[model samples]
Target: MMQTLPTLKKVTTTALVLLGLLTASCKTTPATQSPAQGALVSAQDSHIAYQGRIGHAGPDAAELYWSGTTIRLNFEGTTVKAWLKDESGDNYYNVIVDGDSLHLLRPDTTRRAYTLTYNLPEGKHTLELFKRTEYDRGKTQFYGFELGSDTKLLPPPAPQKRRIEFYGNSITAGYAVEDNSGKDQPDSTYTNHYLSYAALTARHFSAASHVICKSGIGVMVSWFPYTMPEIFDRLNPALPESKWDFTKYKPDIVVINLLQNDSWLVKRPEHDEFKRVFGTTPPSQEFIVNAYRSFVQQIRAKYPDAQIICMLGNMDITREGSPWPGYVQQAVAGMHDTKIHTLVVPYKNTPGHPDRQEQQQLANSLIRFIESNISW
Candidate 1:
């Protein structure tokens, strides 16, 4: 005959005891938390762990964050995620994950931070971040990267990243050089030269580079008709027409080669007006100098840690480069921990644009600098 076990309360007590016994008999361990716990982490009161200032004021300064010698991070799992912040307005970043290129997102007012969700594989992963100024292309201060949570571990086996960024003027835009050199047209513009130095550099370095250069723009100032100095002092002009977003498309390195057009000193209505104001025929060199300084300061304020490389291309717009180079050096000297480089490239056979040889020479100079200062 089947016998009744026990009363309701008695049965409950018995089940509890059995459960306790089973739990005790088996190994009790806490379940490991996934990397998602670090997601949506709060920004308030968060700190930037690896803040190293050793390379903050030199050619490698902008690259300080990614120099591998200074900045370091350890992760447990394969993938990782976090938000990036740069109060100094420095361009220092290179976060990749899971065979995907990380994005250099702009600050979202609604979100109140520049969020980055990187999916790194397992094991220990290295995140390299660096600076590249928007103007002058000079390398300066380099602050390390910030982390939301150091607790998150990389996966057992890590995933890899293959990305690059190209920053330059019309050359990077593939302006004028199309299909091939012989077939390209004048209207081709620098954009046609998609295979220009910037692009080729990215290719050589195996990076997904971002280009932010405009044809006639310069560091502290510009030429042609409107200069950054005159524009800022008199009127804040609208942004120029370009496909690449200045606020977006953050680049690892920026190459600048302006001043070609500035030396033009083209006679225009503005020149006549300037003569009336100064009681002279043309704008004085002092005016140009003042303008350049002011413009450079503004740029520095914008990208505090960017590694900027300023170049004097092969073509010599003004036979006498004394005024331009001297003014440039003076401006760079005033900035804190800035790297200023000058390249005296000779390219005159191609007429308006530098020929293939000239381009190669420019690339050689840049390559040497990158080899000495930055890592891919």
Candidate 2:
């Protein structure tokens, strides 16, 4: 006989208080409740854990995810389904089961339900579904998960203690890093956020990663109207009004990789367009330096204790003598903040951007830098 769980509406505060007491009492035991007791779990149920830049839009929908945001659940069953809402045809995800890569699914509809996995051996299993695309693809809402009658939700894995927040442009978003097509252009099929240096570095350090990035955005200027300064605080990347409450999540380390787009855009012949839009003439080196400094200060204001690393490219901002690297150094120095540091990686010389292989190298270099410098 299978237990029927309480519906979302029927779950009273008193019942929840009792359940919390029960959960606290059994710390050493598995967190799953007996499914035979007729306990139904809703999407908003406390047992279901979420990670990385996630925002709740409504009672049933989880929103504001960039690449690498994940939803996890532990349940004892042979099948599970996720009700996902992604209007864009380009949204994709990687499904992992019991620490194994299972399938890649493209939720190509406005609102559709997907069977994440099925027909597994009956026992406790874990599922991790990762969003594999960046914010530009579109936003996805996780309504909830559906488990089999015999199955019930278990406690999710313990959260990672070390957390890192990466802020940058397309390179940080892993834009076209996997393309290897030499076109120097972004293609949806070639973009894989999981392979980016930010993700790879997070995996190396066993840290929870939050990627706050967009393609072709910089501190002073962007390919589009908005720059990192204008949009970094938003809950939804697509909506300017959706402000993110920064206090909800804090990072031990904050890595800012701006300047690549700015470097290329500011120096180009059509730089007047930037001046027109930004209400300034061609940005001088001094203007860029001050802008970068201010942006770093903004991050400091948000994360007072975080170790800030200002980095510039495995792309155009190559070598020690470059003006771009100087700008980053000058920005950190001007702050007079000892907690902030700077790093510059060697150029990869890839056609479009650092491909997977190059990103791996960059990740390795960053890992070494962190290992040598930061105590963590």
> TM-score: which candidate is best?
2
lDDT of 2 by residue, 194-303 (tens): 77899889988889988898888878777777789998898888888988899988999999988888877776646654765555457777888899999999999999
lDDT top scorer: 2
RMSD in angstroms, all models? 18.4, 9.4
Measured against the true structure, the TM-scores of the candidates, in listed sequence, are: 0.44, 0.86
| Residue 231 of model 1, lDDT score | 31
Residue-wise lDDT of candidate 1 within 1-376, one digit each (tens)? 2112111122111111101000011111122433233343221212222322222222211222211111223444433333332333333233333223432222111112222333333354454332222222222232222233443534332221333332233333343433236544444222223235654565466544444444454433233344433332211023233122234323445455555545543233265433443344545566655655565555445455556665555556424534666655565566545444444444443545544444556667677777787654
What value of lDDT does candidate 2 attain over all alpha carbons? 0.74
Model 1, residue 190: distance off in Å is 8.5
Residue 342 of model 1, lDDT score: 42
Count of backbone clashes, every candidate in sequence: 56, 8
